[model samples]
Target: MINQLLLRFKLLKDDKTLIIVMTLMALGLTLVFSSSMSGNYRPEVMLVDSDNTSESREFINELKLSRLLRYTETDEANAIKNIETGMSIGGLVIDQGFSDMMRNGKEINLSILRSKDSIELIQLRSDVQTTAFKFMSKFKTADMTVDIIKGEGFKVVEDELFEETYALSTYYWRYRNPFNLNSQVMDAQKDWAYNPMIHYLIGFTLFFSTFTIVFVGSDILKEKQQKTWQRKLVSPVSNTVIISSLLIVTFIVGMLQVGIIVLIGNYFLDINWGMNIGLMLIVFAAFVYAFTAIGLVVAGLAKTIEQLGAIVPIILVSSAMLGGTMWPLEIIQSKILLTLANLMPHKWAMQIISQTSAYGLNVSNFITSVLVLIAMGTVYLLIGLKLSKRHVY
Candidate 1:
């Protein structure tokens, strides 16, 4: 077994096709990591001051202090126009009676106009609510001080209105932070989801895996057409030995492919792959084996290298679409499509790898995913072997 594995490893080392695959994988990972990790946040806010009261002006002043928010004060009409034209992501409207309502203990109305960007909208809304609460808290505290000195409930109604405003705004803050709060609390790490290195690594890994199958399978077909496969079949090696040798070679080549890409991501792109290196290696091995089995099945069944080459792109594109390579699966709200995503092995593998990298290995999930991958590989290998038996013709 050791001798066979070593021989296969040497075969892969000399294979130009494997070298090209690894090079392409590395290049793809680099490009993806660079693009995805860059921050996408631009806090452009348009403030519409219909009230133009002292309290509203003070509120806008407080908001302007936030480094994340870029404020442009415009009248209600202009603010609406700017938002409609996509000149700003957020538009804050302070109603004409906003200040009077607070002073008179009446409900104050405010409006937020936002573009179609849900993330930016949610973030800006939360920031506005927070600023409003801070301002109201200061105002209430001052009012309480005056009441204590005067020994009367002066502006008690105003304080009541402030409380009402705070209460109403609390609902908007509920979904403000969609990223994992626990992870943030534990590590004080921001940009949890937008980490370019990690996202790119995962996306590229999946993309490369799906694409490489075609090339690898085509190489096998080419070798067969060149009569290299006939030479292997006549050797004293058993069919199991030959197949195992091929799989071992492919697995090692795959690992090297992933390792080089990961190294580039870590050093050049600054992607944190988390602390569990051993677990990552295990997951990578499993994904490679499973995908290689898929390639083997393709190679075994393909009548010609050209046929294998032509079919691989379709399979890869389909897998990428289903596995959330083009976009995160969380964005897909369709229950039926989401349910179908669960059935995709690429999706499962990508999810398992991503979760493992971010949150460390979830023992149960990791084990289950590994088992599934192995099962898939076993099924494909069985089918390939059955087909290979017919190669005697």
Candidate 2:
């Protein structure tokens, strides 16, 4: 066991370049992505064309004028498909008699289908209604003017004159409309003041930390490949010490890597990690332990270091993207993506970081995230131990 510990340390000492590169990658990516965090994200709406008339075309154009939504014109079947598949937050269906309804000055309802209820969907509904009402009123005004002309005994083509009147009204609505409608979405959830530097610093820390931990944990697989594991099993020390030492060494190395990132975050990036030291310590420990166990689990599953190398990166990168490391989950409207995020350890770690971060968070939510990390770590460790039992003589 002592020999095993020394060999691990010797390997760690020799692999200084990998550790340094990982740290640099984390910090560099944080700086690069932090600037783009405020980039615009418009809700996407699938627009179904049922009328397929000039009136419907103009209305679709009106919908596109809104900067709040990115509308895509699709068939009714496709729109409904996108809505059901979670590819779209919602869909809007134009009535079949939309053009006739406009000509007759009758208001028509736009059908809205929501895949899931969200603030964006609510805002989309309002925008659609506003545009529909504007068109409705414009057509009604044209009808009134045509009626007045008929009453005054003017001999003019009714359809042509009404088209001219409606066109003029639409022009006035665009350039000379006095009512400036600025629609804002007020979300149901409580808002927290987000600090970008803190977020990126925390995010990259969690994301890139997996690289070193996984590589270090692969030493167990390396031992099996070199037949060192068998020799250790036959030694005087119990297998318990050998297993405990591997985890303890990996845990210590992970904590050191975190401390290095903290120092760099504080001094190099000028970030204050907030005053939640106790919460930070426990949560960070849970995060590191969970990932360490995950690495060991990867080790237990793989027959050699080469297999571990191939498996670890995909899991780490994909989990990071899903887990709010690349971006916050609050902006994501897909229920499917959100559900998938919960199954990843990266999500729980990031949630804990966000909760205890500089802006502060709800205590109740913070406790829940922390507990989830602990539970995840405990489960992974047990699974790793179970898998390792197959290798033990």
- The local distance difference test score of each candidate is 0.68, 0.79
Top TM-score model? 1
List of clashing residue pairs for candidate 2: none
lDDT of 1 by residue, 54-133 (tens): 78887788788765568888877787788889888869888888888766656557888865644456667778888877
Q: What's the TM for model 1?
A: 0.67
Q: On residues 12-43, what C-alpha lDDT tens digit does candidate 2 reach at each position?
A: 87557877888888888888876554357576
TM-score of each predicted structure versus truth: 0.67, 0.60
Off by over 4 Å in 1: 1-7, 10-194, 356-361, 390-393
Residue 72 error for model 2, in Å? 20
